[model samples]
Target chain A: MLLLSRHLDQAPNYRADVQHFLFGREFRAEDLPFSEKLIRAHVKNGFISLRPGIMPLNENIFDLLGIRKKWLCARCGNRDQEAFAFCSCARCGKKCVYCRHCLNMGIVRSCTQLVTWQGPEPGFDRAFLDGRPLCKWDGVLSNEQQAAATAMKRTLAARESFLMWAVTGSGKTEIMYPAIEGQLRQGHHVALATPRTDVVRELLPRLRAAFPDVPISGLYGGSEEENLRAPLVISTAHQLIRYAGRFDCVFIDEVDAFPFHFDPMLEYAVHKAAKPGTPFAYLSATPPSELKNRFLSGSLKGVKLARRYHGHPLPIPRFRWIGSWQKLVQRGKLPSVLHEWLKNKMEAQQQVFVFVPSVSTAAALTELLQRNGFSRSAGVHSEDPLRHQKVADFRSGKLRLLVTTTILERGVTIANVQVGVVGADDPIFDEAALVQISGRVGRSAAYPNGDVVFFHNGKTLSMVRAVRHMVQMNQEGDR
Target chain B: MERCLFCGEMRGDPLSFHNLFSPEYAPGFCLSCREQLVPIDPRHCCRLCGRDLSRLDRNRVTEGTCSDCVKWANSGRNGLYVNNHALYHYNPFLKEMINQFKFRGDVRLADGFAAELTRAYRRIVHNCVREQSGILKRKPSFLLVPVPLSSERLLERGFNQADVLARQIGAPIVQALVRVRDEAKQSKKNRAERMRLRATPFQLNEKAAVSLSGHKILLIDDIYTTGATMRLAAEALAPARPDSIRSLTLIHG
Candidate 1:
């Protein structure tokens, strides 16, 4: 066991205080905040020992607080037995079963002791943050934006959960600033969590500029801001697995986004990370139906911002028939109309986003486009390591077109860019994804409107509903 | 009903629980993921080291032995290990799997390779029974001894990869050796440095040595990289005076 301690010490950034590691929830030894020796001593003294290696200090306190068995993981929420395995754990030195569902995040074994903060509440000095305006956003908001912001501030003050069902391009990020400011003024820690890393990258610069005086940090995998214990944290939802009862308020951006919307464990993590009775808000252009139902049934308080931040209607997607796109691409050609559309967009100096269904298709289409004299065009997919640099090139106008997968469907904003879904009817492009893709076209106030085309082999209900949904929102915006 | 042990993705073609557990029916991975796993063809392997020799010219193997084995034979250390059998070529897929098993602490991955390993052990046991003649005829008895991990490495990895592999053989296992000192991981060292790493980290466990007195030993490991560890281990076991020792590894580099 002592030999194991030396190995535990080898963990990078390992701290020595069990309290820091265990606070807010239980933790595996691999993610320890304190020295393994200290934790082992605690376990030896019966202060903590659950499954085997999992040690939570002060078990009696957890019992008193009614902390139940965390059978379901707080990250990715995988409760299936298939996603778990029994192993001879070195930490516990016993046969222990660990959750494999969220293993990629870190091991979550049955005996893995999660630590929660049991001591006096962590409070920041309000005076330290005084004299300076908490929010530095000097621009005035539109009526709907102002209303949503006020409601957000009120919800934070009341410490109640709320939802902002804002449409795409409705300045959802800006709307949360006032509420975030209110929380910061009260010296409360705030977390702005989103589902994707790209959003985290996009929000970090904007948030840093908005609250320069505030110690703000962005949390994501491979993020440099990880070590910063800032009062305000902008993080991807996946990064929230390490936190426990740490935030006073958690604002989840794009609650309907992939992995977060689908994985229950992310929701569990949100509950675990936020302090008890803390305020939270779900900000999404197209929230999941369950959340919508909750809001409709008066179980949730929410606001709707239908119009774009630039006060223009969302660019409604126009469907163009292109029969058997798979066959066309396989035949080394594009649909005549779509090819003409791409040529026109390129001729007019407009950057284009051509969303394909898969990586191979993206490559094939990019090859076809390049061969057809569109030399500045390239394909970008999730597996493409150069996707970031390619996106940067597209943004700087060095590249005229980017053929991509759904990875770029959301949270990408390029001014004067025409958007096209080559396989709009493909099941992968759900209503939410289509809405997000269209939202990308008319984001910038300078170029508030651009063409959004859905070139498909056949019409599908999702496509029709997406078109109807956008036009309906545009009509609602008129009010 | 069957799912990938790693990713939890359900197999498109459902497998019964019995079939799922059976090595012949399921390889413990989904079809897409299984593409990464390339089994070493036995016909294409070196006689001594079990290294894939298909890429080498037939002339390179003199008298059914690779140049490495010939060198060891010439060095008079061929008796250090009777024969080494390995199941896989050390490919990137196996490397990633080993990473999960040894480094990431996902110990259940041991079960994924267990069935096939046990089958291989049984075949070796059968071979031993057939060649029960001369000095080998002293006993049909055998002891399974997994190469011991240093105390520090053991503490870090929690469980030894070789030990886990040996356990899957379903043979009686003994902790016959204790590591006297920890050395840098072999993977981190350059080839020359690894070749020069001659100091034996192992010492015979006196208590367990009594059990190994006259028995044939089946040394087990996760990978047969430089073959230096096995040489040192055999030298360390010389005191116990085991009649003979053979090694079985999950992979051969």
Candidate 2:
């Protein structure tokens, strides 16, 4: 009813109506978001049921013009007829066709109506800046970071997408703070998204501390934060698939990360989330070749921060010949060379991460390491229920080392930890993964240098390419 | 041309000539997604329930039977039905497929399992006909009873998966039972609670009651989890005094 809409508008903050009646769209009875008791009350009072479970309440004649009648994903603009599949929704006791493209987030059935506010928009007050100074990070940005931030802000003002080709540990998050604050001061919404949830976790505290006065919300799977309108939203890239033209400025951190680099659907989601013609700045340590070519041709805007914020060179991984590690593993013994290396690291009290190609190998290495008198080590993979706890225990100095699969290859940082990849020749351990593993080292300024070793049975092109890429980054840092 | 019945994807080798030599070959699904349907390893399974025994703790098994079956035997309901035979594991993939088949009214999916069910039917019931006739027989004097759904559920879901499966098994299907009450879906309940609820929801159809006497009955269903539904159905059918009762399920959770 119009009275209900008015009551909602009078509230302290705007509440996005997740369920409302829309004209011209065929919706099922069961997909209604409200409880049956509430629907019963509305029905009793005079609301007409269009069908068994569908309500055809009159709101505005113009609202019907914007209603999408056909089966299409309002969030991701996915119209591929084959992308939809029939699902028997428990809530709506009918055979509902759902969008399979974004099924990982949650099912969005075709017969289900995703209705937001159709009333007049609310105006946000200047109370967010009520005599409080903006851009409140106590730590000052480095000269390189400041220059990159200026360039990024300029491109945002021009309404053009730009690439921020910053190396690992280059303070990319801090560099975006100025642009976020500028956008917020102008009453424009801004979003910071990364492809990995761990990175979102690491960024939340830093962003909150940097802008303590502003209202910020973090969106990720299982996050308990309220999902209301906010000036600054920090989320994982997958969460952006649900948003629709809500942001004026978007920053896609780790643009080249897994499930986002080669995934065209995620890229389409990024575009769908941003307002038309709005700017997006892609920040990645290793930009994909497509983006790099566009930057080279001057078709896309670009900025680069070559050096680490701590003024140290990126660690170059050196290869070591360890013949038939799998054979030695089957015998319950490590390679002689690797055994000596582990002994020296343990003797020096160095925390380490031993990367393997698969979960089984990680378990095998963990067993072998423990058998070799390294009882404080543990193995972890994606399916491990205690994965987060193990990482925390390792960070708190309770564990001396960890044997992990590629799940931990990116978005994890431990201080003063040496890195080693057991099967560098495996196809799963690609050049991007190797580069990310090396980036895990030399992360903290307290220990700006560490060793990265690729203990391989034989060399592969990916291994050579990773080594060369790291060396090239270091060379550029010197300039 | 054979195609994957799940997503309608075309199989790479639609006609594997080697299949001609292998009687077990059934080109039902494409290789790209065929791994989703995980077959149960008969070697490492509970002798009584056909559940994958590898997942159970070593101390939980006694005399080649899982703890659930041991509990069932202790409850004095062991003779209600013969051992249940399941074809696949009730994994997430199978759960989704079954959900689409039953709740979503995708009746065409039942055709995908026609060959396998026919094979199981011949191995279980047809062998008896062969022993009596001294030759491969075309028909057996056995009643195929599909687990009945309540009238309300029949209206909601539009079809019963067990009926479809039994029809595909190529035997004479007999709707000899009816549900007196519309119990909530077993999927919404926990395993322990589902097993403990000893209520029988079925009653013998009066018209088919006389024929059930002295006839072997084979119960058909989609999944065998905790064995509560089939046990209750068998208990309900005991009044007719069938000679024997058995069950065949598509998946074992």
Candidate 3:
């Protein structure tokens, strides 16, 4: 497992302690038996953590936990009959391996249960989705998105899991509407889970408008809807801590964001919240090639919606290198070119957000900007007490210019704002941050175009690649 | 032979030295015979000062945790534990008698700890219990409550480790000290990371803390760590501005 760690093929911050099941008992790789097929299977699954080896408990799980078997399959009379077959796994190539029948769960097995919470709610209805309906977009769906929706609708009709590989502005949200609407129509509960609170807030009104008569609640940390009695619920992924499979349609928006991208529990939460025959649709701009490869192998159903909602042009980013900011700052000065850009914008009454590599640098730059007679600028970092207030001020124009770290990059948007990234060449700034930060610009159609400047002294590959990717996604939409 | 102090069994878990097993000169033990291990009453011990309550070499029984703890009579967790209101001597009485109560499934030992604590708190608890008691001794500044077992542990044990002891002292106990980051169970962590781990993991209850503004605090915990837990707890409760935070632990080791 450390061999994988050595590759450092993933992000540098990705620390998978392969040593976790490492000591304690002499269990080691090459010691246990996983057929090449099993290893290949999990490798293809992408998120597996040498998982099968961690049996957690091996005895008759009921016998191990000493839990009573409270559930009996109400179907065919065989007491030991297996649960539903993958029948046809829309993921993993399945000939029809049914889940162990007696597991036709939702039955409380308190006696043999080792874990406190039994995952996967047994009888969740579509009514849960009624609480927070799918968002409403007051525009026509692009033909690509319409086609994608029709396909998703058909897959749900057949009970298959699908992956949606739509570009950032490709109206993936609208395509999700049909699936959510179908589940609501079936009277099954629906849950739309995303990785960001900003997106959840953005969708609250949209979903409320789309499913006007249904009960809906936005679920996130500090959210008001813990007593989720609705048919639809919109929640950030982490909020699912209180939930498990209790919904018929689980829409995982932005399936590739932090924590959610790496956390195994989230996958567990999604599976637990989804009912039998429920469909999971991963909505994302970049379909981490691992998932895309799975689709190509015919294991997962892939649908591409290469169209934006308003068909609005994606704001393409152009890069400028303003290298080694620490050296420049050490001289008690701002790089003149970047200084000129900021001065020009402020003079024009335009609002601007500057992204820095780290919190310390963000503070330093905020001080610099404020000292330069841009006194209205304020720093936004996790350590700051009034972060949400600062964001609100930026939005209301109470703050003419705001200096922030990457915290506002992905999830926050201030309307009609131009973007600048100080020291974008710093290794900390990467493809995802750049794309999401650039995305901060050109939010609305009338104000759809905005400039993204990577104020770096030397350009990094991630910068060039991020800009190229944005252009590619936008160009792909044109066709 | 030393009689089993707990369960009054014939066998016990301690080795008997000439005076060690004797019930008289030893300040009471015969741990095996009593069916209850009473923590050996510490002697020559300074009560106001929680040091060598026993004249015995303290070093022989427990190793000093760090240079700081080794040199000082107590880690002196800030001024919070200036008096170090520690109760048990960590003797056969604590090991056997308390475990019998704590794990053999009777919560009565906690109450007994409380009773003994009341004996310790004769001056403080009495005022709190008296008529119009609250208005009586300035209401103990504000309360710097103890860190609790995570929710998982709470469900398993049915109660908090610090709550029972805190409630016994008649001190206003608050459950506001929260474990924000569910740290991996640190039972086995070493000193340094354990110290760093404490910082990122703890937080104060917002409402209880704000209310504590300008008040004195009684920080309570069931057991003391390398003093890392207490130090971190104090930081988490910052901006609440407790006039002075004092710590109380049932056991020091």
- Give the root-mean-square deviation of each candidate in angstroms: 6.6, 7.8, 22.7
C-alpha DockQ for predicted model 3: 0.02
Q: State which docking tier applies to candidate 3.
A: incorrect
Q: How do the residues A139-210 of candidate 1 rate in per-residue lDDT, one tens digit apiece?
A: 889988999999988976898889999888788888998888888887788899988999999999999888
- Score chain A of each prediction against the true chain A by TM-score and list the results: 0.87, 0.82, 0.70
lDDT of 2 at A81: 51
In the range A98-171, model 2's lDDT, one tens digit per residue, is: 66555434345544444323233445445777656677898788888899898888888778888999878888
- Better candidate by TM-score, 1 or 3: 1
Best TM-score goes to which candidate? 1
B172 in model 2: Cα distance from truth in Å?
Answer: 7.1
Per residue, candidate 3 scores C-alpha lDDT tens digits across A66-135 of: 5533222121112322122122221222322222222212211112111211212223334445545344
lDDT of 1 by residue, B147-252 (tens): 9988878866667878888888888898898888888888898767765637788999999999998788989998887677887888899889898888898888
What local lDDT score does residue A320 receive in model 2, on the 0 to 100 scale? 95
- TM-scores for every predicted model: 0.89, 0.74, 0.53
Clashes of 3: 60
- Give candidate 2's TM-score: 0.74
Candidate 2 B-chain TM-score? 0.87
Q: Give the residue spans of candidate 3 off by over 4 A.
A: A1-138, A296-298, A330-332, B1-253
